[model samples]
Target: MSLTDIINAVVSLKKDEVVENVISEINKGTQVDDILDKGLIESMDVVGAKFSSGELFVPEMLMAAKAMQAGLEVLKPHLSGDATAEKGTVLIGTVKGDLHDIGKNLVSMMVEGAGFNVIDLGVDVDVEQFVTQAQTQNADVVCLSALLTTTMPVMAKTVEAIKEAGLKVKTIIGGAPVTEAYAHQIGADGFSDNAPGAVELIRKLMAA
Candidate 1:
């Protein structure tokens, strides 16, 4: 499939075709990060815009994320096994009391697609878990996600744990219930509204 076809299939959530095409590109020696950034991530950016504009809904975003993950599975082996290329490490997870995983999964996939080596701590993760993983992995960034209005406190607690440790790690927070204001109020280093933007925002955090 063409690169554009692969991108659209991901954005539109055309499942099987997206996976098949990403592999095709990989076999052709296309750079994995390019396929992700120029292709899959760009498509997700559109998906996010559609979500904001009401042209797409949660179900569509989930399906598109599924397609993105499929593509990532095909490209991951080639992208992350090198040493000279320092993409930085990030520890990520959904905070406790938030069982909603669709958003968490998309953020994980998009972060991997953005070229960082990510450690996913899974859903319902607690504050101690976030700090422990960040410490264990020497993570460059710590990301906490929450889907409910009530779980925002968990994000704050997670960041607090890292801050208390006196680590140099940057913290990022995101979810439907999260905003830049709330992120700042909670002392998060950055905030993003969607998966692609989250990935880009994390990149910016790491760069600084």
Candidate 2:
């Protein structure tokens, strides 16, 4: 399949078609990451913008993200074992005492779709876990999610742990209660209220 076709698949949120054709194209020697960036990732960049502008909503954005992941799975085998060439490494998770993962899951998919090697620590992740895993993976970014007002403090504690450990992982925090003002107050490197914004913020942080 052509790269444009892959892009269309992502744009249309066709998970099955994208994964199938992407694998077919990969077997023909097209560069996997190029297929990813030019096609799926680029499509998701559009999805993100559409979502922010109210042109799309949670369900549509979630489906597009799912389609992108399907394509990524096809390329993952080819992507493995080239650690030195990765775009960046990231550690992401939802904070402890919060069982909700919809937002966290979406952000994880978007981050992986952007070609970062993501280490997902899953839900109910403790602050220490964030610090430990970021250090362990030598992650360029640490993304925290908390869907409830009560759980949002987990983000701050997570940040503190990273600071206390003297880790240089650039922190990004978001969820229902998270705001750019709150983010800045806590000294977070970045804050995103949505998945695409998260991905965009990561790109900016990496570029900086």
Candidate 3:
């Protein structure tokens, strides 16, 4: 089957079918990166667009992400170092006192699908935790999520802490209560309103 066939399967949320197709392609000597980029990652881009356009909802996005992950499992081992050479590492989490995580989880999945190595720190992560992890992991980007307005200041503090520590990582903030202006005021390198946009923002920040 063509790579687009696999892409279609992922978009349709056929998890088993996506896994089978990925394995089949690998068996046929298809380049692993090609399968990941053309099939699975591309499918996520489409899914993201559908989500942003309101053509799909959270349940659908989650299913598509699951399908992509299923295919990723089959391809991971075969992906050599060179295949991941262009990918950057990201550390993501919701700020301290913010137990909300749906948005953060979505960003994690989408960023992973975009070929970045993601370390999800989970919800209620403190600034010290964020700074420590980013330093330890040598992450290229630090993403903070805050759903509550009260937690917004915590995100700012987290950004400030990372900067003050002289960590060589770009910071991005997002959530229902976050805005680009807020991100800039807090010294965040960037911000995005949705999961897909977050991936793009990270890409730009890394490239810069």
Best candidate according to TM-score: 1
Q: Considering lDDT, which of the candidate structures 2 and 3 is the better prediction for this target?
A: 3
Looking at model 3, residue 6 earns an lDDT score of: 90
How do the predictions measure up, each by TM-score? 0.63, 0.61, 0.61
Point to the candidate with the largest lDDT: 3
Q: Candidate 2's residue-wise lDDT over 73-126, tens digit each?
A: 666556523234568998989899987565676677767767789899999999
Residue pairs that clash (backbone atoms under 3 angstroms), model 2: none
What's the candidate order when arranged by decreasing TM-score? 1, 3, 2
Each candidate's lDDT (Cα)? 0.81, 0.81, 0.86
Model 1 steric clash pairs: none
lDDT of 1 by residue, 1-208 (tens): 6678887888778889888888888888887767877777677778888998999999898888788777766765665332345599988888998876656766776677677888998889988888888888999998888978899999988888889999899999988779999999989899988776887788788777
Supply candidate 1's per-residue lDDT for 203.
72
| Model 3 TM-score, all chains together | 0.61
